[model samples]
Target chain A: MNIIMSKTITYLQRVEFGDCDPAGIVWFPNFFRWIDAASRHFFIECGVPPWHETEKTTGVIGTPLVDTHARFVKTASYGDVLHVRVHVAEWRDKSFVQRYRIERVNPDKTGDEMTLIMECEEVRIFAARREDGAGIRALPIPAEIRALCS
Target chain B: MNIIMSKTITYLQRVEFGDCDPAGIVWFPNFFRWIDAASRHFFIECGVPPWHETEKTTGVIGTPLVDTHARFVKTASYGDVLHVRVHVAEWRDKSFVQRYRIERVNPDKTGDEMTLIMECEEVRIFAARREDGAGIRALPIPAEIRALCS
Candidate 1:
């Protein structure tokens, strides 16, 4: 039996003071910023060309998120280092589901125990410039790109 | 027949140069920031005291998001003024749904049309400090607070 497994990549982020809210916890929105970066990094590490380079031939400018669902499991403050594990959970004709698991190392003298901070699943599409040049439209998933990422 | 209506409020935000990403459009995460502010403003405009004030009496510090779903409909850039319409979509025992609709005034000669930029629905809980004071936990929906918001 051939076993097919999705590729996963880990992205690291350090929480900054400015990322916290008045309650001294991560402002929540910053998690989305890191998730976006991790999504890009996952493709880069998987041997996919940068969107700008691919746009020349594929007309794929970038992945634009259409829908997202996120759950905040724990609160994090500044000075915390987070590990974001990203993978493609599902692939459709014109879009894909990118999933992220964000964790923080245990602080209570535990041995490398990782505590989940947040998890997110986003539906995004390869977007191209519209004919009118005013906005963007989704493109079908590129076969070569999908093979590389998968 | 007696009918009860939930209060709705509109919060305005002005996009700044720093809010845009390298793509020259507003970074997606900033939408969450504006949505959060709008969530808070909704309660304030409805006559609910600030979280800090309520913390003393009700032990409710703030509404923390547990889950969220968002859809991006249009792209926005700097100098655009967005209006976020927010209201409580549902009220559960320990959690509630806060909905936001972000829109921008039509830039074309099309008389004051509002273009939908993004929409989000969040499941949030009224949180209070845990007994250990190390974290937060959800509290029952306070009737007075709900009455004020509704």
Candidate 2:
């Protein structure tokens, strides 16, 4: 079992008007979506995209989160391009834990430094797939993913 | 200035798929969208059709969210239909506060018991509109809405 699969922080931005709330602040849910997207992007860089690209790919199938926790540090507004950093904190034969830090890059937008939106940690399982691809299975992480991420 | 021309309490259901995270639990952000939808629904129930019909009739426009806060308690999972109950917590001159509670309803989905899952508290402000309907205007809340929620 491993506590952390890999640790290479990643970044992204917040665009689109729907990201904001009626109060003009970045709606909290968008933060989670950003974090998830960044983690997926990291995997893509590691050669295993979050979603299986090739049918024979020995990659994650469901990747359902078992638990999620986050803390809000500051406020984010519409049109703010923020930085999303992700790292694998813990890993096991069956599952792994990942964390995220969201910060504000353009102070003029939210008019602040940090503006910590969330410090998030999610525990997820590598959902398994059946031979016929009808139901789910819980399989161990593949060696290539582990090696790349590690 | 008023966001919806009225303050009202709104309610919504927690569907099975609405739980989007792998944790089999409700993700933090989905609650905000539910609250926002319920708020828009509240206006329509109060005779202010929000999306398509009313906005075209009255030159008065809706305000966007500037800030929000939410707290999670117990978890809800598959087949659990949640009840999102909203109330006007504070009705100020330029802005008002809305409080929400996500109750885990019985399997029958009656909401008669209203078993509690979590609660959320958020505040929103209203701005006076510009002549071109593009700029900001600061005005007092309408008397009718205040009377209803006050």
Candidate 3:
């Protein structure tokens, strides 16, 4: 797999205080949430509008993480400006693979320069429903949207 | 799999308001974290101090979740007294599986009368390590300790 550098995509988010764990570093689990949120945003940026805008949509639903792999390279703390770059590496029959590279953008000494915090890949199954409870299942990527991901 | 109605393992935790998303239910992702913490406690109750007390001895350093299968049986609200129940169902050379059920206990519905809210099962792999990260591999269940899990 060719490593795509940060220059390819434009998804960025500032780490919020809530993202940190008792240890002060961003909890390992929250990274998945941040990247997932950004991936939702990246697609919306690609014209899907399905991520953070989820609650507002009239009948829109969400995609749930089916499989996720992350390797924590560095620690991320509260107040860190995380420059997250995302890309769709593979499009499957009813699911797709989203890759994420999270970096701490603020400069410091050991903490200064942009340090690679984590490299992760997550597979999410999409769903569409509006009700009290729902399950995420694989569905065909609409022709209009599949083209954008391609 | 035979269903087991087990005792509720109460782990007191402060609600991190960030656990909720815009819709207000504890964001689905955080439920997995709570499951993790409770699962660790269950192991400790079985006489396995994750990483074997971290400093005294070393066998497996960490037992992180490798795969998770969860059903959002119900929605859980934020700041609720989450009554979590855990059961060890299967064990393997490198990993073990446990089922978790979480519920919102009501004052009126005390003891076995609490309503069931959510259930999740997470599969975790064990490791042995230290603060600086040092451990070999998952050791076999020590005979003395294995007795408690029964």
Candidate 4:
């Protein structure tokens, strides 16, 4: 018997004029915005319920980012169609490494070729509402969620 | 003789409702958005012209992020006033380290101090429009820009 250890999910987005800055290219922060959305989408695609639901069932409020590193390889502008591919790179005891690769699809006669725009690796934690309710704290990686994602 | 090597600039922002997530907390990506704005505001406060103007005089378009590391210490919500303090942590030949500290101020008479929401350190480059006009390329630190930021 063979078992798949990890899975990748793709999230699509259309670049809009509002996403660009005065330089006529996508503002860097917009990339992070899409990445965050993609992160959630990955979980959804893996059959995980929304954070609100998980909050009550497992005391997991959400996955809050602990650290991130990103590299912008190319620039994107309005009218571009981007595909954000997300996956869990590693599952730690209390945190996991979420990785993303954003690409711009170029449609041509020779078929579509994807241009690499940016890549990022982030450390995130499944968080539970703090006892005092002031903020959140990291929770141990849930077995059910990890099994679904894997 | 003493020389001031770096200067810090603070940018003020009002947390808007749309900036929050379904959890009623400021979404993480919005932090990056404000940091980007604060980065630009820092240069503007230091007397650097806007990127469009600098693009004409010097081929410099804008500072683009190459690498970044951030930690979220506390969560924020709508109706809060945030102060983002930005400064240069290191000056490289072709890239510089820009640092940011975001704080939520509590102005009650009880003297409760401000809360640190997040902190980030980003490696960015002085970007110039590529000769091929496709994307941007890193440029050596311009003396005038360095002098202003310093």
Candidate number with greatest DockQ = 1
Ranking by lDDT: 1, 4, 3, 2
> What is model 4's interface RMSD?
1.4
Off by over 4 Å in 1: A109-112, B1-4, B109-112
Put down candidate 2 lDDT per residue, A3-107, tens digits, no spaces: 643557668786568876554456666776787687777667766665545224764555655556666555666667788888777768887877788877755
Query: In candidate 3, what are the lDDT values of residues A6-36, reduced to their tens digit?
Result: 2136567777788764334465567667776
Instruction: Per model, state how many residue pairs clash.
Output: 0, 19, 11, 0
* DockQ, 0 to 1 scale, candidate 3: 0.14
TM-score of chain B taken alone, every candidate: 0.94, 0.72, 0.73, 0.95
Worst 10 residues of 4 chain B by lDDT: B106-115
Off by over 4 Å in 4: A1-4, A109-112, B1-4, B109-112
Q: Encode model 4's per-residue lDDT on B1-150: one tens digit a residue.
A: 987557999999999999987666888888998999999999999999999899999888899888888888888888889999999999999999999999998867576678898999999999988888777899999999999888
Q: Return whichever of 1 and 4 wins on lDDT.
A: 1
Note the DockQ of each predicted structure: 0.75, 0.14, 0.14, 0.63
Runs in model 2 lying further than 4 Å from the true structure: A1-10, A17-28, A35-80, A84-150, B1-10, B49-60, B108-112, B127-139
Clashing pairs in 1: none
Instruction: Estimate, for each residue in A1-150, the C-alpha lDDT of model 1 and write its tens digit.
Output: 998799999999999999987666888899999999999999999999998898898998889899999999999888889999999999999999999999997767857689899999999999888888767889999999999999
**How high is the TM-score of chain B in model 3?**
0.73
Using lDDT as the measure, the top candidate is 1
Ranking by DockQ: 1, 4, 3, 2
lDDT digits (tens) for residues B1-150 of candidate 2: 765543446475656665656534555456656777776666556554453432354333554444455555555665677777776777777777777777876766464666676666665544444677434444455555456454
Can you write out model 4's per-residue Cα lDDT over A1-150, one digit (the tens) per residue? 987567999999999999998778898888988999999999999999998999889998788888888888888999999999999999999999999999999866476589898999999999887898766788999999999998
Recovered fraction of real interface contacts per model: 0.77, 0.16, 0.05, 0.66
